[model samples]
Target: MKDFGKDLDEELSSLDAPPLGDLVGEAVRQGRRVRRRRAVGAVVGSALAVAGTALLLGGPLRPHSGGAGPSAVVAADVPSPSPVVRQPVTGAALLAAVAGVVPDGLRTGGYAAQTDGVNGAQVTGAQVYLTGPAGTGMIRVFVTSGESEASCFTTESCRRDDRGQQVVVDHMKGNCVQDVVVTSRHHDGTVVQVNVATCLAWTEAEGNKPTAPALTEQQAIALAGDPALSVWMTAEEGLRAKAAYPDLPRIL
Candidate 1:
């Protein structure tokens, strides 16, 4: 699991923001940025592709909606697995949140917890909040478009989460749009995330190995589909990520 996390982190970082900023990874200073959807939530990733991405037009994607849940992406860049929960969490209690999800040994040292406002009100209208437990500090996860709703990605945080990965919910969306995230927590303590606000959803998990927690290139791109989250992505500028980075193959 640890090996997978490292690989996936690398992939998400290549595309999303940076390894530390991408999916599951060691704590960084949190100064990374990626563009996707419309809003700019947490800027991070492992292997996010560039150049002519695999996105639809500005309008709707006419994507298939599976009644069961959303799509999942496995990152090929992941090489390690370590469970770290996001901070300033909602709905579920901490600790109990990711209880049965992380691998026993991975959580041996116990979980590190922390929380912080993304920018402390640097941008107007929208408040970006970056929270989550790192080895010792906290990593930002979600962004609140309005004052009312906020969404985050928890990789199998069963304690704090009532819903599993790939499932969408009307949790905090103002009207009924729904705040959603793409999680990759197997029933066996491997957790990852690639959350979305509106259009599409994706997860960050290792692709080939069964131990990493990074998303494949595709998953990284899809994770960036939040209508609001995309605003800060490199894709926002119309750069070609797809044309540049090819879709990573699935080996595991």
Candidate 2:
């Protein structure tokens, strides 16, 4: 009973004071650890979001193959060219072939047919002169079994056929006015020549010889490029024709 309240108060005051400094330091360290963890979590979340955005915007990603990429495309196949085939023909047949291509209004004149032989190999050819109607011009068609000598002499106007044969068209002056000579060599050793010689004077004139040909440069080229003329190069046909027409005039 003697001063009990006072004794309790004294006892409470005597108890050890709490450690304020240690408690404040511990709280600060805990706060710093939580902030560092939040910062790390934020960085990881941002990286994942960027990856997802790229996947959404761009096309589907493909694993890289070791070789060429999609940009390297392949090409299609191309077909090969066709081969040329030649047929046999006689000198008369050769002239007929030439006659078939000539335009209308020209009259056929005297023709010279010849076959040259060397070591038993014969070369057949022909030359046919044509008189133009209405005194337009004179035309000559020459077919041979070998290359054209006239085509090699001039380089004035030259071209190539579909078979890559050279076609030479020359314009001559002097006795013949506006003369055109078209010559070409075929693949089968056949030469075709078309000469258009127009006479300066009428047919009755004394010394007025043929001037220019009746055909144009283009017409002559087309005639020379005809594959039907290759028949003159056939040995069998030439022999048969020679045997049949033994009295035929030989003019080479």
Candidate 3:
């Protein structure tokens, strides 16, 4: 029982947020019903909900009688929890987030966001063209689910942010490519990446004419860390938006 309590404490501490309600009080009251399997199940269920993750119950348990009976370890075969559903951020909203951080001299050009098939309703990610004295370039912002990571290239530098995220900066300056990229991993494992390149679009080989990127590495980092840009949509919301707005522009 001592070991079990310690395991529960450790597991709860590992969570990003504290568990809701006083589970300890409930567990203490319920522990007296030693013969009721249903009560044990209820406690386990509540623990799972509080943890927001699977709880392994391999910790030692004490017998109801004072005398030692059998050394038994109980384990439950609970299904893994589902991923959290979220509302996807629109292209316009993402662009607006970038607008707040844009430098004074840079003027935005044609911008687009990822659309839902042919319907035109945009969802997640945005790219905008920018023209300034430093050079003509583009800034693209996108959010990706899951914890995906790529090693920094030779021309790039990787650093850890104070907010507990990995920040990768790439300032590729040479004869052909001149761009600055900042990739920041969000707290929830989602990634917010900002790419500021001299090219109008990544697809255009000849568009990389500017000697320097319109936005600098620092600005790119700021854009990546913006709170508004770190949003997502659920599958149902995406489907509804796709049908609701057939006239949305296809910018991406």
Clashes of each: 75, 7, 6
Off by over 4 Å in 2: 1-90, 117-123, 131-136, 145-154, 162-164, 175-178, 200-208, 231-252
**Candidate with the greatest TM-score versus the true structure:** 3
* Candidate 1 Cα deviation (angstroms), residue 102: 3.3
lDDT of 2 by residue, 1-252 (tens): 011233433433443422212211111122111112121111111110000111112233344445666654323222333333223455555555555566667775445454333223333344445556545454445444443332333334667877788776655543242256566767755656555555532223344354446676776787777786653334455455456545544331
Candidate 3 Cα errors over 4 Å, as ranges: 1-86, 115-123, 133-135, 148-156, 171-178, 202-211, 233-252
Query: Candidate 3 — what's its lDDT?
Result: 0.48
Winner of 1 and 2 under lDDT: 2
Best of the two (2, 3) by TM-score: 3
Look at candidate 3 and tell me the lDDT of residue 226.
59
User: Better model by lDDT, 2 or 3?
Assistant: 3
For candidate 1, lDDT tens digit of each residue in 1-252? Answer: 112233434544554321222223211111122212222233222222221222332432343444433353323333334333222222112222232222233332212222223333111111111122322111112322211112343522222233332322212222111123333322222233332222111224531121122222233333322232311223212223223222312111
RMSD of each: 23.3, 50.1, 24.0
lDDT of 3 at 141: 68
Please report, in order, the local distance difference test score of every candidate based on alpha carbons: 0.25, 0.44, 0.48
Q: For model 1, give the 10-residue run with minimal summed lDDT.
A: 121-130
